[model samples]
Target chain A: MKFSPLVDELIKSLQCLPGVGPRSAQRMAFHLLERDRNGGGKLGDSVSRAMSEVGHCQQCRTFTEQELCQICSNPKRTESGQLCVVESPADLLAIESAGQYSGQYFVLMGHLSPLDGIGPDDIGLDRLETTLSEGEWREIILATNPTVEGEATAQYIADIAHDCDVKVTRIAHGVPVGGELEYVDGTTLALSFSGRTAV
Target chain B: MKFSPLVDELIKSLQCLPGVGPRSAQRMAFHLLERDRNGGGKLGDSVSRAMSEVGHCQQCRTFTEQELCQICSNPKRTESGQLCVVESPADLLAIESAGQYSGQYFVLMGHLSPLDGIGPDDIGLDRLETTLSEGEWREIILATNPTVEGEATAQYIADIAHDCDVKVTRIAHGVPVGGELEYVDGTTLALSFSGRTAV
Candidate 1:
């Protein structure tokens, strides 16, 4: 009923992936062992190589092979001192895919979680302060998600920006563009009404 | 807008997993890089080791490190001449988890997909024929799925069984337990009616 030791290890390691439970992990292991060893090998190599090579960008804290992330290193992104602060690298990627934000980024990598003992220091808040103190940015955009923790993190960063004499702005919070009013939650509806602007 | 070359390769390779798409692949890659690099390394090592060391069982074509799979090598499993043929190792694991079957297994890996250029040999059917010719089995259970390709594969194997003077049996096709009749499809209904038992 159990797999061999090597298979078991692979399955166990797969559980580290978000949303993958034991059953799915087992399925992934069996799929690799049975059908596509080459793919599995490539995946393994990539994981190891990337993990060893990739580190936080010295400037923005996003993952990068070099000292600074590509975005932070680019000369074209520096003209506008409009910086976007996001909760994680994935969030940074989402904004990058939009292709509209030419501003640079600062990745928090995690939100402030007081209950879990994750303080500002845990999420590179000190580094963010050092970046803010440089006084290069004219405007800072808080693009964290609309969760309670995200809001708290934005407020904390906003206060820091005010201290540095930088203008701070929060991304809009409302019903999503394609979302139906009937299905939108109460808080979002209230925020939409409160944050509404002239058409 | 684009990940570095190493990050991009990792994202692409993670897509080799079943049900993972581009977005999820990126999420997985970031998870490994940011949170669980040690786990990622272990997963990579396990995948490489499993792929290189594991090969098809000489007896049943299931994955194994040795010449024969654990089931085939076990003395307790050899007493019965019942062989359950399935489409993939995942299916074999499903049956083994049920803990009722006392016999062995044969993993076909895939069904006869003529459209995809997968013939009998593609699923190791020749090896199956050779095993059938040995005349060791009292009954061969065709436990392939009920899809069209699966049915064709089972029928083709049944003919081979008939030629070898071995009895062939198909697993029952019935309304699933706890399923409502109103939602059961037509073909399933027909098969359930035709295969109804005295109970």
Candidate 2:
């Protein structure tokens, strides 16, 4: 609090951001003040500008300053068939970083949780249906995380998509690559044993 | 560019701040997207606001959103007749955390560096003279770091304040508590030996 008002406020404000403890916030505060005055200022400007400029792309929920995100606006991406579903923009980001998938994404901000009163409508399942109903989708890949709620959500969606002609599949979650048989957890080992294939 | 745009941009922006390397940037980026959404947003907002709103206080050069910093504006602090000069706001924060110094600060923002083309005017030495000339100051504590530039800066200020009736002093830097004598630098050991007092 003995710091300048701006310094104090900046440190305290950063404390609100997730995972940013008071000590880290103080370190950040010092960093901004001691170095990177221009870059830090530019980042602030960018954050506000991006916040105001970027909106969810009409087709996908990716962060974009324009009406369409760069990926959605690009003509190179496939116009039909492939669609990947994810839990949040963060997950979509992870997939994009891999650069392995060349398809579109549907982001559900949260997982379905009936216990928390979150129903199918709460996580964009209706939107998924509407998009599928457009008859543009071919293979719908459920790329949500391999957690309890994620599995349940995938199952529920798989049932609903069964009425349509689109081929529905959930992303596999088994033993990691190069993992030892002894190191694999019970769930993963069970999944691996059940999902085993011919040599 | 290999990272997601959001992650890449945030990481790049983070590099501008002091002490944040690739590791800290990655952690901070993940934190913003995942852990502390509200706090992260708040930190971003605070930074944006502070960068735009707060600037160097006209008198002491400390950052403040107002025309004057809180220390400058407060009547009680002014009456203390004490001015603690430091190289940066980080130093000011450190001293304040120590809670021993309740006096006002004159943050130089940078140390004296002739090779770097830095001069006294660049670091507010001229301003300090004007403030000292007002004859309100009693004690002046030179709290610069023990670096070469810091020592030189302190000596330079002491020279200028020679004629003033104020008591000028430099903080000692020698063997730290729990420091092994063998680990102490020869220079520090010399100072400790020379500055030794009779018990």
Candidate 3:
């Protein structure tokens, strides 16, 4: 037998999360019901509100409830004249957390996948081209994932930036810091060597 | 920078699940926002409804929107006269999935833990006692966990069942099936030996 109808429905609905499966969903449902009803209620309200209200920023396509996201609305960020392109908002946040860049971002939301019929327009490249042409960007940085699709997407965006007369660069591919060279993939090792710079 | 206000709030609220951390919560939030708004909306609605409407089953104390849980309300299950007591609804579901028990269940919601200030009433033991006294139960099956608190709870409930002139039995403790004896803990190995029956 299953949990009561409402409890069962809650469990099934929870499986929409990226990594959640049956057991995890059930545990989450029971945890909310038994221990943290207030938290659960808050979560429900927040999810509903976010789903209905959150929309893409007019400039960069990052998530926001406003017409323009906070970063896009900030004159200082816009004045930085450096645009970083990433595959998702999570990637944008990762770069922000590093505290290395102070530029505006254009979130692709996903890379171009020709096999899946995902093209330039699907990842908002048309908007990226328009921004590149309109903004006084000194440089465009591609920080998409290190995969075939990401490489193709970066190349495509780089061409667009070149046509707009803006310099473009891809984030370096190399053995990650704190990682052993022996454990690093051959392609990454080769790229590290090819892209090496003098100290 | 963090996500926009509503998206950020949604990520934080998603962390209320048992194993979800900041990273997992962010991933979940972005996933729902980008890919599955319908599922996320349904999750929110179900969670809100369940939080507001679901309550303890009056008869067995398991979670249910109705006065009695499905198992408690079913006449066929009630007629079995064997009441299995478990520490949580999850545990009750586990037993039901095993397809071994057909009797009604009494969910304790939690075992007795006095140091944490949880008492009999905190786990609905008063209601359990009332049901035990009022029903014509043939046997009371104690299926609480094997922890110290669980043992204490089972002993306490056993005394109550004894007062009602009902036979009480604790689920056996032993090395788990399919587990190597060499890897089994000494306590479990000893229990396996002590509880061994004639072959």
Candidate 4:
């Protein structure tokens, strides 16, 4: 039943991901050794690379490897005078994969839930306000999730953006009521995409 | 939505986990940044610890840190001549957590799936044969899973051990039909312990 410290450590480390229990973690550890030796090797390399290279963008709160995240730095993508605000990089990718919008983003890392003591300041709302005050974006899109906390966040952002010169908008109902975008089927997601009405 | 290369890379890297999709991966990346700033910082450190530190034991095929795994080196663990042979370290841990066994282990690392060309030699069966041939073991318990592939692998080991002078045994009855030991509750697993009948 005993294992080497590092091998044991590796198994424990894999458990940190959501839903992976001890057994799955053990399976994953062995999987790295068995089916995808190269993936295992690549996984180690990637973790180290992302850890050292990727960082936060001061201006937009999204993760970046350089002074700004690639989205904020690039000159080619249609900046379009629109800023889509999201709760995390994951949500950003969900929107990106749909291939709908051509605007930039502001990833809010956390949602505003006061019971958890996550307010505007806790979720970098003040920075979003200051950036909106500068009047760079034509329409500020609130793309937080449809959760209770997310709706509160959207309302909070709407109030702040409305005071600024920017046109306040909450990106509409592509996501289902009480449904996580992660669980939504691709077709439904696409339907939600086409049906997005103004907030 | 347009994103930076850093953003893209982070998402793909996180998707390496079993159940995590692209969206979940994105959320995880953001979750790490927001909630576990210290844990996030530690992730980079743990990646290298796991990567460089883990490797297969030269003797047993079980993962280990040193030249020998902790079990192989320990004096407290049974040197009592019984070897519970399993296909992976995960299996060994499952059996061990039941607090039932007082023997050492010989993990085959994989099963003998002939169609896949994973025969005796391919799955470290050769090493097991040599260990059995040495006549040091009192019994070799074939504790492979109850799945078809696992059954096939177990049969192959039983066949090889048939000619050996030592007693050969197989764990029985506690595991559900077509159920994985990973999913079985600990109490049932313990009951499986008391219920173990020989091959």
Question: Could you tell me how far off, in angstroms, the CA of residue B133 lies in candidate 2 after the best superposition?
Answer: 4.6
lDDT of 3 by residue, A1-199 (tens): 8788899999999999999999999999999999999999999999999999999999899999999999889888977789999999999988999999998999999999999999999999998888888878898999999999999999999999989999999999998999999899899999999999999
DockQ of each: 0.61, 0.36, 0.87, 0.35
Task: Write the residue-wise lDDT of candidate 1 on B72-189 in tens digits.
Answer: 8898887898999999877888889888898988899899999999999999999999999975889999999999999999999999999999999999998999999999999999
lDDT measured at residue A71 in model 1 versus the true structure, 0 to 100: 91
TM-score of the B chain in each candidate versus the native B chain: 0.94, 0.85, 0.97, 0.82
TM-score of each: 0.90, 0.79, 0.97, 0.78
Clashing pairs in 3: none
Question: What is the Cα-based lDDT of residue B103 in candidate 2?
Answer: 80
lDDT, candidate 1, at B158: 98
What's the iRMSD of model 2? 3.6
lDDT of 2 by residue, B36-140 (tens): 555556667778777667678787787777778887788878788899999987677788788888888898989899999999999999999888877588889
The most accurate candidate by lDDT is 3
Candidate with more favorable, higher TM-score: 2 or 3? 3
Q: Mark the regions of model 1 whose C-alpha exceeds 4 Å error after superposition.
A: A33-35, A175-199
Identify the candidate with maximal DockQ.
Answer: 3
Q: Please list the residue runs of candidate 4 whose C-alpha ends up more than 4 Å from where it truly belongs after superposition.
A: A75-79, A98-100, A146-148, A173-199, B1-3, B76-79, B147-152, B174-199
TM-score for the first chain in candidate 2 comes to 0.89
